[model samples]
Target: MDLESHRFISYFLPDQRPELCHSATIEKFPPGTVIFEENEKPDALYLVLDGKIEFSKRGGLGQYQNVAWAEENDFFGEFGVLDGQPRSARAVTCTSATIAKIPRDRLMDILERSPGKVVLQLFHHIIHYLRLTTEQYVNQMVHKHKMMAVGEMANTIIHDLKSPFTGISLANSMLKDLHQDEETQEWCNLIQAQITQMVVMTEEILEFTRGKATLNQKTFNLGESLEKFQRLNFIYWNQHNINFILRCDNIILNGDENKLMRVWQNLVGNAVEALDEQGGQIVLIAAKLGQDALIKISDSGPGIPEAIQSRLFDPFVTYGKRGGTGLGTAIALSIVEAHGGDITFESQAGKGTTFYIRLPLC
Candidate 1:
């Protein structure tokens, strides 16, 4: 079979396929080559004869967010071809690739002559991939929150044992004071040793399980903190089209860096997911306000849906995106409160959203 027979162009009627096939010029590009930039006018629609093409966007401060990928036998730039609009996402070669570039005019001409089958074929592939990604995302979220539940339960068990154990130790001390005979003192000592062993064993178990063990607070520069955050997330950003822009005053903060990092991540991650297909921006800002450090995370996507606004911090609340147990925001709120901070947000439908956080700088 000919090369065109293996691609999306094959969906066209047999008689009309020849013209479209003839218009395509096969070309080879090395890995990491940029095929097109987002918002650039389309020159051609490309088909992957071999290798892979990543769809991503480079945004403010040169942050790159990957949106999707097209592998062997797949076609890209369909939106530009169908509507003659600027490209929505930038395309780059992920590996050495042999690609067939079909001029836009020829592709559009064939579509004009036979639009029915080809148009449906294009949209069907689009919807199918989205459905698969979404299902996988929801499943992963469910599993994550369930594990978090186990962690929280384990922490609660540890906390409850402390008070009763302290009471038992105090009572044991009184018995020792009341006893004067050697035999009575020996029995008291045995009970004390057993209690010490119990406390040691309980601590070891908690150390073994190690779920958020305790908040390790330290002083850190807020600007430096966010820069590290952005660098660490390059791989995660490779799956969505969202840019993170940070503005900070180099304010010093005393808190659990890891936990605070989780707070920012949860908020920014939700922004990226909410902007799926639409693409948007995330702005992170930090500054000292009085004795408190003010942190603001903003997103340019559609604002939070009104239905879930009131209970957004409630244990299982979620909105506008995939369905999942909504423990993320609640956990974020809990962490901030634990550090004596406050969290709140303001959102307007279609205008986007911004979340505010305040924590003691000292």
Candidate 2:
């Protein structure tokens, strides 16, 4: 039904003066046109006469999340118009559409002249809309609470394992001195390496669960740190026949060296896992981009899977890797962001994935 023939509007139009009724104007908008934005004062009430309109709220990083859709016979922007308040969400045309816009002043004028029946119908629609919104909000809150509970439980369990891992690390260190045979010594070295990895993993989990990463800031050489990490992982990378290359100038940095090293460890480790012993190349390029240190890690692996790309940095999001807790990227992101920097990546299904890390240069 068109706006003039709309039940609520038609009920009141008979009592309104002709000019007041004429104040509702028909507006045409092309696809992707924004009708209104959140926080803007409502000027008019819009009723969708044809095509579709989407309502969204801004999410993290300037993303817009769809809250609802209005199609034929649906009226929007009424809440703000009635309350004389700012819009709670943004409205945009999803497709080429025609909408009827009733100016707020004209709407109030019509309601003042109309009988109690017209106001009752308006109230019915508003109450129904509010009920649905409340239901959605409650569901979100329940889901958030469930996630918090699971996180608290996981943090306790992970915290309890730290002492036992420390004991195992100490024992692994002592075994190196006790075993003198060449073959036995090599095996002990491997065990010690694995224990070291476990120690790093444990630390990452604890830090993530705490939600606040404390940095031990100091001036250090970025290039030297990369070289040392590559050296330490040389044997592991070579075992998979993966060619690892580091091309970086000796850039000095002022940050937490240990935390930054952990970021590198996680990124490099993920790249290696993506390669999966099929012999691919991983390159670490560290260069200066004006006042920022730009570091890019590119891998010629299969690339990140499409399913988890949106929540890639969210904790406990993992793909097909065995024994994966999925906290590596999350921890890496936390550390980098804590240092007043950002991390982003580009990936393609068949080609490869590249991660870019930008940190303020000192």
- Candidate with top lDDT is 2
lDDT agreement with native, every candidate = 0.77, 0.82
What are the per-residue Cα lDDT tens digits for candidate 2 across 1-362? 66666555654546464554478789899999999999999999887889899888898889886667788878899888889999999999999999888899888877777788878878888899888877766765564565566567667766787788688768876887787889777767666655665655555566566567878799999998888677678888999898998999879999988788889998888888877868799999999999999999998988899889998998778754666767789889999999999999999987989999999999
Residue-wise C-alpha lDDT for candidate 1, range 258-341, written one tens digit per residue: 677777877887888888766778899999999999999999988898989998987667876686457568767877887899
TM-score of 1: 0.43
Identify the runs in model 1 with alpha carbons over 4 angstroms from their true place. Answer: 1-213
Show pairs that collide, candidate 2.
none
Model 1 / residue 25 / CA error / Å: 94
lDDT of residue 216 for candidate 2: 76
> lDDT value for candidate 1?
0.77
